[model samples]
Target chain A: MPVLYASLLTLFLILIPGIGIGLFNMKALFGIVVLYGAFLIFISGVIYRVIIWAKSPVPFSIPTVCGQAKSLPWIRQNKIESPHTSWGVIKRMLLEVLFFRSLLRNEKGRLKTGGRLLFYRNLLLWFGGVLFHWSLFIIIIRHLRLFLEPVPSFVEFIYGLDGLFELFTPPLLITDLLILLGIIYLFFRRLFDPQTRYISISTDYFPLMLIFAIVITGLLIRHVQKVDIMGIKAFLIGLFSFNPSLPKESNTIFYIHLFLVATLLSYLPFSKLIHMAGVFFSPTRNLKNSSRMERHINPWDYPVLVHTYEEWEDEFRAAMKDVGLPVEKEN
Target chain B: MVYDKGKVITGLVVFLIILLSPLWYNALSGKVEPSLKLSMPKEEKSCIEERMFMRSNHMDLLIKWRDDAVRKGIRTYKGLDGKVYRISLTGTCLSCHIDKAGFCDRCHGYSGVKTPKCWDCHNIPKEEGSKV
Candidate 1:
């Protein structure tokens, strides 16, 4: 089932761009409309999934506790892991969201002396994960130049900072390289690691592969194919303005890049990637662990007629007497 | 114990508020700018005057084309000397025109093209005497 789901997702992800490119390359109005319709479906699906997950039954308080649970006053607690207070939870959530701290804590199994197996703290996965995510975020922010009017100064600053490590011709974007490298490392490790591969379904590999394809296609368009950036911007602006005019000389490579982006957008909500939104709605991350501190009566529980212990005992006294059962009043 | 209607009501109300407040704000804050009158060059003035006749979409298109010219780094924007102008046709027009039909399906709206992703960079209804 996991393999099927992942395969279907990967197929959709890959085909969406293929279809978008086919349509966009044709420059047909119907094609563009279809693209928009596809986008609508994608957006709707994402929201639906999020809402359903948000409404899912979290019947128990099963937070992955790693900290001291606000117990004895003198006990020292791991504030950042097993958070007991709202502030602590927030701190924990920040680390989880920004750093993937839990994943960072993952230990790699190592074979030691005399064939004794041991687990050692692995920082590479954590570093790769963080590098990929932050770099991807920076790249996205930098690209906001193409989308926003007056392009926020922060975006420009980031763009400049990203270009700081450029040592080659045309000024290489370091974040781009980092993200590419990170994706590559992650992909190979997933494939090469024996334990990971043993448990890994095709679904796990699909997203990584899809991302790799996207990065490659993007790089090709930027560096090799050399699509006219201005023309592309014009196209985007034109798309944003409700006037879709193609320049007489349009580059096919630009269409490929756009197709991939559009595909990613439409696919985002349906896939594991929707975790972006899921992270916010997560009861674990968002909800305060105030169960012990404050009463959390189930909001869904219905009101019912109360029967006190005394009343119950009185009702059951005759039956208890017949059964020779002891009671407060020995009938 | 069964369901609590009061709690459900509270949750629903909170959910509605969270979802609708931003949408309400978005709708309330949107202000469509007034369309501009086209100030044409002397040779093309009469021709454009007959065509536009106070219609703003035409002016909007003209401004779009001019901005497109500037964005292409075209030297066509007058009074800039010894500057490199990269004159080119671009997809800016298509971005907004393509999205118009679905976006403006109401009010008997009619546009020659469909795009909605354009207004990000250039000002719509381009102002007269503004630098390209």
Candidate 2:
């Protein structure tokens, strides 16, 4: 049911701009309105989510400690795993973001035919994550060519390097190949893995299906169903300039690819994908493990009214005398 | 209610800087013109294929021509207009395109595409092609 819904929804999204441009010729609506609206939503939505996360006060220095913390001089501290200082936290965050250290280090449990429990590190998921993220980073950076006028030297250098193989007529870029492989691996992993599939909901497949269509449409425009490169650039430039114009030589496939991209951006902030921003705000990942060395007081802690022993004794002196009991004060 | 106010500001500043880098870079340069125009052939009234087809699918056509000529030992191409043209890049494409810099390099440079390996095999022509 999840698979059917995701695939059907993706097909419907493609047909939207496809039919809009192909039949109705509403280029301006998709080209200008949808694209810019998505951008506005994406930027503001991400910022809002980040700010909302920042508003919540962290009440503890409870960082997840996997190794020896900073203590006695003779005892060595595993700084990266149980960070005590801000600098150590930074290093740990870098390792987590760049390398997916947690995923790589995490162990998976399996049950054998003989009812034996086995524990092992699953590298395929880690490898797939790394592949997908790095490829995405490269692809996004390369796309600066369309957004920036007189493309920067670094962009040009990377572009040349990525297309070094220069195999096909348009050149089969390595990142493109890697990204496709990564996405396919991710989709099948989710489908085949028992634990993952059991926990998976419909929304998980939505992004995968949408991105798959987007990538396929992008490949089609570049290699198979070609579009006018010149006109497309002009249209993009106009969008950035806040003066939108529909190109006369536009292709339906290009519009479909673009619509999918816009949809992804718009959906990012509201979905689980907001973790891109939330990662930085994570208490476990970002907090310092200095609970013993420093007091971890709650920010909302406030003072309360109190009664002194002397005041209580003075008030009860008369009552004590009547009852013939000893008192600290004389009447 | 917020914790780490300084860190939050710094994070947001950094995020905005990277996200808006393209806009700022382009705005500072004050150059908005899309400079990917190709110089058309002067004497040739029509290409082997239509102009629109040539604009987008030229690379595929060129590759097919190269394979057909070199690997299959086929040297003739049947144009959509039913004209037979020799499958030679230097003798045919450059005869009209003339200036490689103006006709080819401009688009490639603007798009940040690597200079194709076509020149490794084909002979270099004089700049008079642009003058033509």
Candidate 3:
């Protein structure tokens, strides 16, 4: 039901821009205004979330360590597994952000007929996640061509590597296929996998469907229903340059693509998709496992009124003597 | 109320740099608004297909021509105007847009696309009349 609702919502989003541009003819509203607003929202929203995380004091060095702690110099320390220093934490974070090191722990154990336990990783989730993320990154880098007027030599180099196979005439990028495949795997898993499905909600399905719609619309603009890209590029140049205008050849599919992407951008900060920024702020992942080595102190510690045990005994001694009760001090 | 102001600011600055990289690059290199002007053949009133269709689907059409002429030995294409023309890149296509550098490579460069393998097999068309 969540999947169905999410799909229907995505369908509606796809139509809104298409019809807004195609039928209603509100190009400026959808293209320039809405998109610019979304960009602003995304920038502020991410910063806001990150600042909030920054303010939330991590009162404990509660890092999740998987290996032996550092003790005797004779014994080898698992620096990566249980980072005790800043450098170790940095390396751990790099591995975590780049390779999804933590997600590797996503495994299941099964008992075989021979009474032996087999523990295998849920490889599809990890693989699909990496593929989808990396593909999306490459695709975004590729889109820098539109925003950047004189596309840098490096971007061109990436373009060449992406289209290394030269599948189509203009050179189809493998990332398009990769992202689609990855998202499909992820989506199917969410819908069908018992554990994932039990936890899956509309939020989970929405992003996947929205991303699917974005990619499909982009593909539509490029391949199936081809629009004059030159005009679109010109329009984008104006957009980036602060000299905004709609192109003569501005097509509906393009508006739809832009709408979906901007929608994702705006939705990102508020949605679960904000794990893009949240991962860096995760205390468990980012914290150093040096609790034993160093004294932990709250940075925001403030002066407070306190009644010490001695002070309490001092105040109560006279009363206790009057009542013949036990007192710490005698006068 | 933010703690670790240095790291948070660094992260935000990095994000901003990447976000505005396009604008920064453009500012450094100057905006490349290459108004691509393809010199139409003098005598022809219109191309085999309309201009917009040619602009968008030229690659599609070119590939179709390559497959038809080389693979299937089908050499003639009936235009939308009902005129039959040779399905040839060099002979039919390049004969009109003779300045491959100007007519083809200009937009391709603007779009950050390489001059694809269409020129790998076929000769880079003569640039004598190129006005780009």
Give DockQ per model, in order: 0.03, 0.61, 0.65
lDDT (Cα, 0-100) at A235 in candidate 2: 75
Identify the candidate with maximal TM-score. 2
Fnat values, one per model, are 0.00, 0.61, 0.76
Model 2: runs farther than 4 Å from truth? A112-116, A308-331, B127-132
Please provide, for model 3 over A1-331, each residue's C-alpha lDDT reduced to its tens digit, 9 standing for 90 to 100: 9988998999898888878888989988997899889989999999999988989998877888898778889988899999899999999999988988888888978899999999998777789989999999999999888778777888888988998988776677889989999999999998888878999999999999999988988887887888887888888877777888866765788888889999999999998999999998988888888888898787667899999988988988888888998877685
Q: TM-scores of the models, in the given order? A: 0.65, 0.92, 0.91
Instruction: Report the CA-based lDDT of candidate 1 relative to the real structure.
Output: 0.58
lDDT per residue, candidate 1, A1-331, as tens digits?
4446655775665555456555555654323554566566665776577557656656555566756676678998667766777778778878888889888778878899999999999898988898889988887777755543334567667876776754432246788889988988887787788787788777577777667667776676555555444344445444445565653324454554555566666777777788876775566675555568776655456889999988988999999988988888764
The 10-residue segment with the lowest total lDDT in model 2 chain B:
B123-132
lDDT (Cα, tens digit) per residue for candidate 2, span A1-331: 7888889999899999989999998988888899889988998999899889989887777688799999999999998899998899999999998899999776789899899999998899999988888998898898888777777889988887888888887887788889889989999888999888988877888888887888888889888889877677767877887777776666889889999999999999999888888889899999889988888888877886777877887888888789998877686
Which order, best to worst by TM-score? 2, 3, 1
Weakest lDDT window of 10 consecutive positions for candidate 3 chain A: A245-254
**Residues B1-132 of candidate 3: C-alpha lDDT, one tens digit per residue:** 787899989999999999988777877887565465766677777889988899888889988988898999999999988999999787888787877667787788888988777866777665454322
Residue A297 deviation, candidate 2, in Å? 3.0
lDDT of 1 at B77: 26
